[model samples]
Target: MKKIQNFFSGFLIIFSLFFVFHSAEAGFFDWFFRFFGKNEANVKKEEIVLPKYYRLGVSSVGSGTVIINVNEGKINCGNECRKIFPEKSLVELTAKPNDNYIFKSWSGCDYTPNEKCKIEMNKNVTITANFAKKENVVNSQQQSGSHSSKIISSSVSQKSSSKSSLVSSKTNNSKLSNSLSSAASSKAPSSRSSSSSSIFSAELMEDVFLMDDDGTLIDSDNKLIDKKIVEKFYTLHPQKTYYDFLSVFPSFEPGFQGAFHSIVKNDVKGIGGPQITSSYLSDSNKLIGVNFLGFGFTSPRIKTEDDVKNNLHYLVHETGHQWLAYIGKEEGFSTATHYTNWTDTGFIRDGQQWSDVMGGSPWKDNGDGTVSEIITNKQGFSKLSLYLMGLASQTEVPDLRIVVPENPQDQSPFNVHVRGEPKTISISDIVSRYGTRIPSYQTSQKDFKMAYILLSKKSNPPTMSQIDAINYVAKYFPSEWNFVTYGKSTINSR
Candidate 1:
């Protein structure tokens, strides 16, 4: 009896406290909540973190529309990509910081007009949408069955608005629940619905590589020096070394194979092209066997004049290839130009965004290299197309067969090669002019090192491309490759 009475007394005290707090106009809880509400309402803004010098943009390809919503570290795509049989669309997102976040895609494939892309929402955030258009849709699915239907995932939280209302359990976290609920109720897309089973998905991964804030993707690291900074010595004095105006671009389907094979043959010593991709294997498996150029040109920073120049050059060059791919002329041996083919009308006109640096020019016709014709020459173009069709392969660079020819014997009299159509050099010729010994370069000459070092220590070692650049610079300019002694000031000037 005594225990029961005590328990009842305690319960009564708690209940009375709650009732008083709920009703009291001047209670601590009431005053505290009121103050908080007033402050929150009065505060008209929130702080947004941005890079010192960074830009973010979106580009759409094909007949698809893409809407990206960004807020407080959350991102979503609305109807970004929808596959219409014989009609396809593309949407791209580019970010500068090397941070991790979630991405959700609401894609409508399977030719379902009613099936629109949706987003899973979480937290208070803002989002923007962009769209791209294309000509008549064609069903190339039969030929490219190897391709998977691109999907925008729901790696982040998402919510969808539907005609028939449905209820979802309130999340335990009140703030997150409220944000998600608001997003779902705010807008029902002005699109139709379908029974398609394709679902939106998202995931958090390492920062995307070789993608500029401008949304361009590059594939090589050679651009580091050429794109980062301009060397005053090279510009004024012009000491011609083998690598003057060399510009390397990422190859597409067939071109990718040729480029891969080039690396395997010239860079990766001992690696044989035949062993790279066996015809008996599937296309996806073949990629694994090839010496895919490590994604190098994707570094976000342009530290020097060379970097800016090279990056811009490579950007336009690779974008040209992508442009070709966007159109139907990706496979055939057509000249690289800004001209568009209106086959239906039997006319070809210059593309609106075409430029000489991109398509074909005088460089494509005459150059010193064996595969001359711009980098888009017959050989380069042919190799790329063949590689894509699994008709060719690129192995890793083997160490054994690097050939160093005598300087005087080589055909090209010039020791250095500068920017032009396809920048290249004979190793024998460069070594003779630049000397077998390393040159006097400074560590500051290469800026991506700092970012690469930090990322490597925090994550994986510098990627293959990073390693190659370091090796090349270190071998030719040993004094410049300063060891970064952590927690000590022995080598660092900064």
Candidate 2:
């Protein structure tokens, strides 16, 4: 019985070895463990291999300009690109597999065959090859199935390396995305509250200067200085750049033409319009009380009932008159013609305004003689000058001229009784008006020499012959016209 059992065991062992050897040869083990095999069912089938150095160019309809670039190991597109794109909704080009290299389209492209080619984005134009996908095969006219074997071999090697790199890259990218998302979410709440507080603070301030009948917040200089009230202006624009101040002023209202005309005609004299029933003198002396020019600032304290009705207007009007005087007194301002003949009605022009343009602010007088000032006195002149510069779009250099009177006579007659039409005053006309002789007020030798030097320095200053005459007046004619020296230099004696 023992011998029979030993023979059966030996036979069973041999049969097991034979079956194992045959299964390995016939791929029976692979079929049994199909999930782990390298067949189509187990692994992803390879598609057309794309090159490492490749780009996908996209175009769309209704789009202006488009440029995509690979920078800092990332993709960027849209308005960030400097290149301008044609307007389009959809325009795209894709790739296809050939043999060793991928085939790129110059025109309409899709992945599958039999996709109808139609111009949906651009209308009425036949499709043509504007660009190619592959730079190496760009010029080749013919298509071929055969590929460079060396390129294929290199591509396979590169693809293996790419797979490894992609795996590591994906791990890094996943970690980065989580970090950025977390950081943004954490900051969102605090940022939102800050923005809301800023907005609320601004609304509180707008209620203050919301005055102009036109809803405009005008500066003391009469220019539309701000649209929002003072508090809102400072709140919204925490950083006080020139552009911030610019935003406060509103644009000229189109419907207020009649209001502007009435203000110009009634408050300001010498404005060239037809005769009015009001017989206010249009001459220079009457203009003294008229605040043609000045600059100031407004504050919350100005809201007193008395100030609201009268004081504001008085302050505004007076500053306007003073500004007109200053602007007229400037060395080269053609408007000086108006000052030289302050009494002539011809001094007023079609567009000029004494209340609005000159001072920008108009005030009405209360029982108190003291006019309320908005801006501090120190900044008043500078503010007035800035307002004028803004009106004329003057910067760095002012384009205005100031004309001093040669005769210093009162100009309030409303008619021309002088040697010539008011417009006749030119560089040469100044000498004729002065009669080739300097006035008596400029009697200092040093002051006389400085005046001549400054006259020479002006690219288009008064004439040198006129300067020489002015010098003689400063040195010799001491009893006449007690005009102060006009030199920028302060010291009169050598």
Best by TM-score: 1
After best superposition, candidate 1 residue 64: deviation in angstroms? 39
Q: Residue 493, candidate 2: how far off, in angstroms?
A: 53
On residues 1-494, what C-alpha lDDT tens digit does candidate 2 reach at each position? 99999999999999678668777665655655553454546556665331121113333221111222222222222211111122232333222222223322334443223212222232222222222233353221121342111122122211111012211222222222222333233223111111221111101111111112222334444343222233233344344222201111111211111111111112222222122333232232111111111110111112222322222332322322322433333333225312332211111123332222222222112223222111111112222232221221112222222222334462222111222212222323332332221111132112211111111111111111121122222232221111111121121233
Candidate 1: list runs displaced more than 4 Å.
Answer: 1-287, 290-410, 413-455, 458-494
| TM-scores, one per candidate | 0.17, 0.16
Per-residue lDDT, model 2, residue 82, is: 17
Question: Any idea what lDDT model 1 has?
Answer: 0.24
Q: Each candidate's root-mean-square deviation in Å?
A: 31.0, 39.7
Q: What would the per-residue lDDT of candidate 1 be over residues 1-494, giving only the tens digit for each residue?
A: 99999999999999778667767557655555665685455445765332121112222222122333233232222122121111122223332221121122223222212223333222111223322322342212111332222211211222222221111323122222223223334322122111121121111011111111111122243222212111221232233221212222221111121122111111111111222223222222211111122223322222222332232322223322321322122321122232121111011113212113322212221233222111111111222222221222322111111112234343221211122223333324322432321111211112211111111211111222222232222122212222211111111123
